[model samples]
Target: MYWEDFLHVTAAAVENTVSSKRVDQFKEALGFHGIPAGHVPPTFVRTFSFGDIKGLTWPDAGMIHAEQEYDYYRPLVPEETLFCSQRIDKVVRKTGRSGEMAFIYLTQTGKDSAEQTVFISRRVLVWKAAGQRSEGVPE
Candidate 1:
């Protein structure tokens, strides 16, 4: 029942404020102790990320984070508020060593109050076919 209806699952704008505390925490998590908190870490927006795309079927088990890529127009700064949104970009089906599986690509974009793009994050999630085993794993 994987219809193209999922293509319409774009979300409404989600907003977040980049606070000083958030910057510090994100930096600390990455083990950057003395970096200026003025510029946030490249992946800091993940702290306020959302993945709720309508009609998307998330696997309860055996789902893997296949890949992630980020494009930064500029570094996010503390005290800057950003409006963000997420959508499902595409879905692909393929048969590999693990059997038939699906790859779902999702992307999130963040913009400043002035409507300038700050960054974009693209992530891929893999849903493996039932009963499939990864290579080198015992059946």
Candidate 2:
């Protein structure tokens, strides 16, 4: 997995976007996890990402509670709700127990109606061995 230092992906805000299809999928997942329906908030989708990194570039660990929040802009809803995802933007080296590991992340943003700023999102994951951090290796 360490060799997977770089990656690029493309995705979109289709008609079934976070507000629709994803909401349904996440609700289903919650049900499978023994959680009641509606227990999972729409924001929980933020938890469903590649964010396993910690203490280094792990965004949540680096800044203000690793939080993401936004309000619905009914007026800004696009004529075509389908959005797109782009490539993995960055990856960085980190210390690990077994040796070194890479932290990989990607970005996805969407714009509508010439809004000054659309949606900017990032997903990240760690490439360290199970005990890599315990072994104290630097990548």
Candidate 3:
């Protein structure tokens, strides 16, 4: 299968409920004494972002997370339910020191119960085909 086949593909929407305990655990793990009122940690959305990559088959042996960006429309509140979905936005191929690599761009979005967009997370993942030499590895 070609990379083009994955472009624009969307995963099924999933619902996530922000639990106060989970938030507290996250805060504690990160050494945050407290957060601003009415807002969960921005990185908390990572709990839902993985749902975006489900059901996609990659031709590569593994992938590296190259970049991540998040656009927040509003503060995410603890105890709020969010509906999240992910889509493959674009795919680009390039020759790198490791050999040929594929850059997969994906967007994951979260919406509130009221259907307003809460956040959009964009990610870039780098992948090398099976058997491709990695950087600095002797052939």
Candidate 4:
């Protein structure tokens, strides 16, 4: 569909819990010591953020992650439960040598049991027009 139609749309909230084991494993994998500043492991951002968008229909042509950023409002503790939701902030279309492309801007936010925001992750996804080929991008 049209990019404009998806703007401002929000997905359902999903609940997740921080696992100490996973956090420790992530830190060990990256050679980091104890959770610094009480922040959740970086990996948690991606692992827990996508649940809200699972019901959305994505283009079959595939997509590329163009950019991503995270904003932390407060430190998270192990075993803390969070309710996360995703929203489509904006969608823009442009033409390039490859073909028409859509830039989808999304924000995923997490809130703690007390409903205080813990973190927000923003991402930009590039979806190429169907049947178009780009160098380094498999058709």
| Highest TM-score against the true fold, candidate | 3
**Model 1, residue 77: C-alpha shift (Å):** 1.4
10 residues in a row with least lDDT, candidate 4: 130-139
In order of listing, the candidates' clash counts read 0, 14, 0, 0
Error of 2 at 4 (Å): 9.8
Residue 104 lDDT in candidate 1: 72
Could you tell me which residue pairs clash in candidate 3?
none
Quick one: best lDDT, which candidate? Answer: 3
Candidate 4 lDDT: 0.74
TM-scores for the candidates: 0.79, 0.41, 0.82, 0.79
Model 1 CA lDDT for position 85: 84
Global lDDT of each model? 0.74, 0.42, 0.77, 0.74
Per-residue lDDT of model 4, residues 1-139, tens digit only:
3555557767777888887777777777788876464566655667675454433566555688999998998767888889899887987778889887888888988888899999999999888863455443322
Q: For residues 45-116, could you state the per-residue lDDT of candidate 2 as single tens digits?
A: 353333222222322221122223444333222123424334555666667565655665656454453433
| 1-139 per-residue lDDT for model 3 (tens digits) | 4555667877777899888888888888998886754558998888764364444554434688899999999888889899998887988888878787778788999998899999999999877762365442211
Candidate 2 lands at a TM-score of 0.41
